[model samples]
Target: MSRHILPPKAGHPDVICAAVGWDRPLQTYYAQVCFRTDDEPDEGEALIWRGTEPGELPTPEAAIAVITPYAEIPPRLAEQLLADMTATIGEKDGRHQAEVKRRLFGSIH
Candidate 1:
């Protein structure tokens, strides 16, 4: 599994983290939004939302795109997610970049 931990957004204080990753055995990607209160440190994070019904997303970037709305990640973070994906996959493949941008932004600007 390849996991990227995204920090909470200021506007959404309850959100603690957003995790996006790939499941190699399942050959798919997944994303989860988690929350945790200061008092609940021992209890661990709680799941707020999850995306990409098993085996749905083919790439890590797609998983990021699917989770961005619910996680409310900033555009800069989203760009970083793309960059991380590029690093993992190696090289900035135009096809993947275009597809991820289209999915995340509704258009490749």
Candidate 2:
């Protein structure tokens, strides 16, 4: 079964944006923050992240690990973003894909 914790009309998230970002690759969106206009073309899926308590991040490593769940990409995207990943995202040149990801990131929040 699926799970959603955000409550509507309570200042909670309303939709999830699951996409294969070029930069982040696959950001698994779990927040309910989408619109009907957005639902049709993209076929959005919610993303979920994992992070330690907000207050537990006092050091650099801790800070990096904490509050990370909020902006995690989907597994597919993450795999591509991996530094050592030598996989082919598409048959075309990989540089184009990187450019697309950069532009998408710049255009959105």
Candidate 3:
């Protein structure tokens, strides 16, 4: 399982944090948006949305699509999250590893 903890954004003060990642064993992507509790800011976190259904989100992109509406993160941050999630999966897939290397080093003639 690969998890990324998104930094808190100023625009969304009530949002404590957002977690997005992939579960290798389940072969599913998941996301969780957490909010600060009303009574206690530091006490605990409230889950506003969660996408953990097996087979629901087959790809990291699909998970991001479902999470976008709720998370409300900046475009750059969202892109970074997607890249991070994909990298996690790439580590497990040989094809993806080669693709990553190509992107990083270009085609070696």
Q: What order do you get sorting by TM-score, best first?
A: 3, 1, 2
Candidate 1 Cα deviation (angstroms), residue 98: 34
User: What TM-score goes with each of the models?
Assistant: 0.51, 0.21, 0.56
lDDT by residue (tens digit), candidate 3, 1-109: 7777665655777777777776653456777777778676864374644444445566667666655655655556557645655665544435764575467546311
Q: Model 3: which residue pairs collide? A: none
**Tens-digit lDDT track for model 2 on 1-109?**
0122322232333333322211123222122333224445354343333222222222323322322333343333333333212332333425765576467554221
Q: Say which prediction, candidate 1 or candidate 3, comes out ahead on lDDT.
A: 3
lDDT of 1: 0.60
Model 3 off-target regions past 4 Å? 69-109
Off by over 4 Å in 1: 37-44, 49-54, 70-109
Model 3 lDDT-worst window of ten: 100-109
Candidate 2: stretches off by over 4 Å: 1-13, 23-34, 38-80, 83-85, 89-109
Clashes of each: 0, 17, 0
Report every candidate's CA lDDT: 0.60, 0.31, 0.61
TM-score of 2: 0.21
Q: Give the TM-score of candidate 3.
A: 0.56
lDDT of candidate 1 over 1-109, digit per residue (tens): 5677777656876676777766443345677777666777533375643443445676556777766754655556545545554554532326776687577657644
Q: State residue 41's C-alpha deviation in candidate 2, in Å.
A: 11
